[model samples]
Target chain A: MPLTPNDVARLADLARIELSDEELAGLTGQLDLILESVQVVASSVPPETTPTSHALSLTNVFRPDEVRPSLPVEDVLAMAPAVEDDRFRVPRILEEAA
Target chain B: MSEPIFASAADLARDLAAGTLSSEEATRACLERIESSDGDVHAFLHVRADEALSDARAIDQRRASGEALGPLAGVPIAVKDAFCTTGSPTTCGSRMLEGWVPPYDATVVRRLKEAGLVILGKTNMDEFAMGSSTENSAFGPTRNPWDLTRIPGGSGGGSAACLAAFEAPLAVGSDTGGSIRQPASVTGTVGVKPTYGGVSRYGLVAMASSLDQPGPCARTVLDAALLHAVMAGHDPSDSTSIDAPVPDVVAAARAGDVAGMRIGVVTELSGEGYAPGVEQRFQEAVAALAAAGAEIVEVSCPHFSLALPAYYLIMPSEVSSNLARFDAMRYGLRVGDDGSHSAEQVMRLSRGAGFGAEVKRRVILGTYALSSGYYDAYYGSAQKARTLIIEDFDRAFATVDVLVSPSTPTTAFPLGERTNDPMAMYQADLCTIPSNMAGNSSASFPAGLAPEDGLPVGFQVMAPPLCDDRLYRVGAALERVLTERWGAPLLDALAGRDRLSEGGRA
Candidate 1:
């Protein structure tokens, strides 16, 4: 099924990317072409075939709960776009709560 | 310009060890080359001449004090900007993380420093390693050194271009799909994608976590092997890292022998879609291996044709999930932070503004595919297709020691050729995606110039996981044969042009 501009706009919202109407229109066509090419995957493989999420068969890779040196707080905070009082300063999450 | 500027990493290492050359001198030569050529090449995103000299001088001092050092110590190497470095910015060719200096080094970068290799600077790449052509890079495309009008194949284009342009003797590139090998092919440099989990992925800004593998790029197979040895092996920090010894790639590279080895020609990866010049050179390479006493047989991997469609689904799915960390709450570019806009609005605006078109396209595609209704039809089926591709490799490797194909369908296409067409751009990696899908070891060697375009073609070799040595063996053998046939290394043609420009009075 060819994706419409509405589908791309919905997807952009789900992906947390604010796209303009122009971008949504352009993406709809390009993405439709790409989806058309890749849609063969549905028919190409047998349904009974098991999916391989990872190339290797590794599972439940766990390490001992040991204390390790971590990056310093100041160093970590220095890279933040906005920081205040040793915390990452983000835009207000809830306007009423704020 | 001096001879050492274009010397192989192996030769430079030997000279440094023999006390005939100082690390400072070699570092300076590379820095000077970058200064002179990188303006046109645009291979580097960042260059740290002062830090590189300091590191080289430290290595020189250690050598003078009779202290032991690794083989690659004091060798100047360019790193792809995707790898996080403490001092240098790790942009990954995206405005998202522009000028963002990483708090720590990537495992590969840490290893490079541990080996005493001088870090010259970070090279450009596709934003978050998304596009096949470096044209998607926000910084700008890295021009092909051979022909400035053409693209140097990407996301590792800068790393490959630096080697081709003699800016750096060795470079490190992360290959998701054909990022490293394709760029290497077009620029006439050597690149390897080691077996998945063979190299630690820690600190490598995730593109597709399952497929991304960092490897070495160099002028020669042995130099790639040497750098590979320094970079590969298990790291506890990366849970996916394989707890196994690195294959003896250096010995295999030096062996350069395909004698009595059974080599397979992947039937699906060639013909139709493949350019005539690329097919011609690949067939000649197969013949050369046959002449070297290797038994050649055609192996049909039917499912290989489905690799491209499957990769587009799987890679984008992973990309969507992986790139979600770029929320405006933390590091990287944040937009719409004015009091009126909420945090969510800021995240939406930042991601929309920071990412390039290709990135946004894939993210949306992935979000659609992974959505409630389309999950099984798109992402799940693609995963199943991945299983079949692996099985095909298994069946092929059972009979043959290694598989060979044209690394790309054609030589480097002109810049802006496929910028408007994502499908055409994705076709550049048709022959290369199967290896990544299977997590096998693959490398691209110079397969002489394409007869029509006079541009470089890459001969790709694939080996089963942990059997990465076989790739070096095949690459070295072909490099030897092709170099002999061409009467010199393939890059000599590019260097000859450079000499002309240098010798000519303006």
Candidate 2:
């Protein structure tokens, strides 16, 4: 199926990255081309082949049940864009009852 | 120009340990070259001249006291920006992490320091290792040292260019898809992508977890192998690290005679899309290898045809998921924070402002592929294709020691030639992606300049997982032939052209 501008917009919303109207218009064409080229994957691969999530087959990896020293708290908070009381500060997530 | 910093890391180390050359002198030589030529090359995103000299002085003192050290001690090297260094900015060439300093060193960085290698600085890369050409770098693009008008190949372009321009003897590059080998191909340097779990990925900025592998870059195959041995080993910090011994790559490089060794030419990676000049160089390399007593055979990896499309889908899907960590609250740029807006709006605005065009394109494509209704069709099929690709490599390796091809379909294209066309940029890694998908050891060694355009061309060799030594053996064999034929290393031919670039600087 050919990609449409509406599809690109929905993708932006899903990815949580806002794209301007002009940017969406531009992405529509590029996405369509990319999708068209990549469609070959669907046709080329056999149905019985299993999906490989990782190149190597690694099983459950567990560590010893002991605490190891980690990054200092001050250093951890130093990288945050906004910090309050040594914790990350963000905009309000909930709204008052309306 | 004062004193060429182009010596191999092994030679530099031999001199440094033998008390013939001081580490301070070598670090100064590399720093001076960087100051003189890096203005136009843009190979370095950050240069720690003082820190590097201090480290070199410390090594010199240790050497003066008769202290034994690693073989590569005191050799100057460039670090790709994808690896975090405590003293230098690990920007990964994006506005998202602009001016952000890492709290600690990447495992590779820590290993290099422990080996007493001088850390010159961080090199430029495609933002978050997204694009093939360094042109995708948000800060700026690194021009090819061969021709400043052309690209240096990329994501690891800065690392390759540093070696090509004689600024650093060795460099560290992380390969996701073909960031390291493709760049090394066009720049006439050697690039190695060790077995996926062979090198620890503890501090490498995640691109694609299953695919990203940090490896060594250098002018000679032995130098790369030397650095490879030093940096590779099991690390308890990273769970995916292979808890086994690293192959004796240095010995393989030293004993680089490939007599009676079978080298297979990958049938699917050539002919149709390869430029005539590039193919000519590849065939010549094969012939030279055969003449050196290596048995040549044709191997068909039919599934390789789908690798690019599959890689496109899979890499972007991983890119989207891994990059979600850079939310506004924790680190990096945050926008639309007037308190009039909510966290959702700030995230949307910040991401839109932070990521570049190619990155945004991949993120959107990934979101679409992983979204509802299309997952089974797109992402699912791509993973299935990945499986087939890996199986294909396994089958081929069962018959031959290693496979060979032109590292890239064509040599370096001009800077803006493929920028508008995303598919074209993706094709830059066409010949190199299979190894990444299969988690094999792959590398590109300088084959000679293309006769028509006088640009460097690379011959790629790949070995099955953990047998990285074969890559070095094959590469060193071919490098020996090509060097003997040209009467010097391929970079020797670039000296005159580099001087030309230097002349145009002022």
Candidate 3:
């Protein structure tokens, strides 16, 4: 199925990225070509084949449950674009619970 | 200064310890080389000249005080920007984190530092190691040292270019879908992607978590092996790190004996798409190994052809998930942050402005794949294909000690050749991706120059996990044979011709 501009726009919204109309139009064709080419996987892989999440099947790695040093507040805050009161500050993220 | 710039990292280490070369002198030589030629190579995104010189002086003082230092003490090494440095900006070639300095060092960085290697600078790369060529760098593309008009393969292009241009004797790079090996291939350097989980990934800017690996880049096999030895120990900080003794790869490189070892040639990895000159050099390499008494056999990995398509899906899916952290919240560039705009709006605006076209393309594609209706069709199927590729590798490695192929299908093409063609650029990683998917140890060594274009071609060796020594063994043998035949390093032939007009080629 060919991707429409609306599809890309919805994806952009889900990804939290904004795109111009020109970029949206441009990406539609490119993504379509990419999908069409990679669609070979649908035919190539057998349904019963197990999916691999990683190259190695390592599971449940645990370090000692002891307290250790973490990054100091001063150093951590230095990397933040906006820091206030020893924490990261961002634009308003909440609406009233009403 | 001239002699120090072109010396191997191993030789530099020996000279530094013998008191024939001081760390300060060597560090100054590399900085001078960067100052003189980096304008043409565009290899470094950041050169820590003051920090490097001070670090070098400290090492010199330690040596002068009669204290024994590590083997690589005082050696200058370039680091890929993907790895964080505590005070230096780690851009990963993206405007998003243009000037973001991390609070701590990556495991590899800490290891190199403890080993007494001077941190020369952060080398440039494709944005978040996304594109196959360094052209995707937001700062600019890194030009190939051999032919300035051609591209330096990437996203580890800066690391490879540093070694090729003699800016640094050794460097570090992250490989996901052929970033390190492909760049090493075209630039005539050595790059190794150790077995998955072999090297810790504590602070590498995540491109694809599962496939991402940090490895060594150097001018010679043994130098890469020595650097690898320093960085490959298990780090308690990374959960996926393998808790096993690191393989003695330096010994293997020094041994350089491949007699009676069975090397397999993957039938699916070569043929129609391979440039004639690349194929010619690869076959000669195969013959050279045969002459060195390493038995060569042809093996067919039928699932290999579909590896590229599956990689595009899996890699982009991971890219989308990994890059989700870049939403203009705590760190990196923030755009349209007016008080009136909401958090989501600011995030959208920032990402829209900060990300490059290739990055945006992958994010959208990945989001599409992982979306509600399409999950099983694209992302799920690709993971299954990845499993098949691993099984194919298992079957092949069962019969052979290692697998061989041309690192890339062709030599470096002119810059802008594939700028608009994603598929063409994507194909550059074709031969190098299967090993990545399988999480095997793989490396690229300069095979020889391509006769037609007079550019470098790379020979690749893939070994089963934990058998990384085999890669060095074979690579070292080939390097020895090829060096003997050429009578010098391949880059020396193009010594004075590396520069081109600022407008591009002559």
Candidate 4:
């Protein structure tokens, strides 16, 4: 399947990358070649074959629910670009539930 | 005192145990080598000299007091920039994480420290391990020690180059799609990519999550095996880590006997289009294995033809999702807009300026894979194809104990040759990517030098998922044979040529 320019634009947005017009144009052709090459996988196997989630079959390997102390807030926030009152300042993700 | 500068980890450990060399001296020699070589090779992104020396001094003092030391005690090893260190910045060679230091060490980093290995520094890499050549590194590409104008191989080029330049005896590198093995092959070093989940992935900056396996790079198989043994074993922090017992990798490598080993030569990996010199060296490696009492038989995994394509889809899709964490708000290098502009604008500006061109290209491709309507046709189907590749490997393993092939289609090309052509560079990994997709263990060691270009070529060895120990055994056996045939290790062949004339020297 071919990707529309709008599809590329939306993907770039979701990935937080800004694509230039020339880049998008070039990506269109390059991606087309790659997609076509990889499309061979579609017919490589039967549809009924169960998909393998992992190579090995060990299961239920979970860490004990021990509460460990995290790095101090000061150190954690130190790397952030915008911090206010010990909180990471981001463009507010919530706009009050409708 | 610097007697162990270029010694293997095994030799260094033995000597340290016998009081022939102190941990401090070993660390100092490595530091001195890095100081002299890094100016030209640019192998390290960050060097922690004081901390490393301090750790070495402590180990020496402990030994002097008759205290026990770990198997790799006193050895200095370089960590790839992708792994987080508690106090050191783990940038993954990208501007996005330029100043972002993790407060905790990666599982591998903690393991290395626990094993008493001195941390020399952080090596450079492709941005998020994304490129075939280190050209994508925000800090600039690591030059090949064999020829400065050529690439060292990515994204673990710096790790391999450091060992090749005799700066570090052992280094860590993550192989998502042949990053460890490819660079090792090009630089005449030893590297292994253990089965996925064999090494904990807890602190590695995620690239292609399912495919990334942290492995070792060193001058000798025993050195790589020693580091590998320490890095292996289960980690509860990494949900994907296997609970199986870590095999005796160092002992297996020392055994060095392939007698009665059923080695399968993959038919798909041989023949036309492969560089003649690469094929010649590969054949020589095969003959050496046969002379060591191993039987080589042709085996075919037809699904392998689909591996490269499957990898392209799966890798990009995963990269897009994994890299989404680097928005302007969280951490690291960011360019933000004032109150006049919206938050979205700040994210856009920051990411646009932060990422290199190749990284952006992958992110776009990945996003497209996960996009509505295309998900079923691309990512979903590619994953199903991954199942087929794994099954194919399983069936082949049932018949043969191990598989062998040329590590790459060609020797290391000039630096600028494939950087401009991403598709061509991607094709170079076609042979090695299948093993990663199947979650099998594979290794690459110098087979011989390509007669055409006089550059090194590597032969790859693959084994059943948990049979990683076998790769070391076979690789070590072949390393011995090839070294003897060449009259010395490949590194010695380039002795005088290593340093250029005063006019051309960097």
lDDT of 3 by residue, B1-506 (tens): 24898889889998998899999999999999899889998999999999999999999999999998999999999999999899899999999999999999999999999999999999989999998779999999999988888899999999999899889999999999999999999999999999999999999999999899999999999999999999998899888899999999999999999999999999998989999999999999999999999999999999998899999999999999999999888789998877877888989999999999999999999999888978999999999999999999999999999999999999999999999999999999999999889999999999998999888999999999999999999999999999999998777765545463343543
For candidate 2, lDDT tens digit of each residue in B1-506?
22538678888887887788899999999999899899889999999999999999999998888888888898999999999888688888999999888888889999999999999999999999988889989989998888888899999999999999889999999999999999999999999999999999999999888899999999999999999998999998788999889999999999888999999999888888888889999999999999999999999999998999998889889988998887787888988888877888889999999989888998888888888888999999999999999999999989999999999999999889999998889999999999999999999999888888888889999999999999989988898888899888888776655553563321
Model 2: iRMSD? 1.0
Error of 2 at B29 (Å): 0.7
Best by DockQ: 1
Q: Provide the lowest-lDDT 10-residue window in model 4 chain B.
A: B496-505
* Candidate 3 wrong stretches, greater than 4 Å: A95-98, B496-506
Q: Could you arrange the candidates by lDDT from highest to lowest?
A: 3, 1, 2, 4
For model 4, how does the per-residue alpha-carbon lDDT over B41-111 read when each residue is reduced to its tens digit?
Answer: 89999999999999999999988999888889888999999999988889999999997889789999999
Docking quality band of candidate 3, CAPRI definitions:
high
Better of 1 and 4 by lDDT: 1
lDDT of 1 by residue, B1-506 (tens): 24888899999999999999999999999999999988888999999999999999999999999999999998999999999999889999999999999999999999999999999999999899988779999999998888888899988999999999999999999998999999999999999999999999999999999999999999999999999999999999899999999999999999999999999998888778898999999999999999988999999999998999999999999999999999978799999887888899999999999999999999988898899988999999999999999999999989999999999999999999999999999999998999999999999999988899888999999999999999999889988988899889999887777732342211
lDDT value, residue B283 of candidate 1: 94
TM-score of each: 0.98, 0.98, 0.98, 0.96
As a whole number from 0 to 100, the lDDT of residue B341 in candidate 1 is: 89
- How much is B299 displaced in model 1, in angstroms? 0.3
Q: State the C-alpha lDDT per candidate.
A: 0.92, 0.90, 0.93, 0.86
TM-score (C-alpha, index-matched) for candidate 2:
0.98
lDDT winner:
3
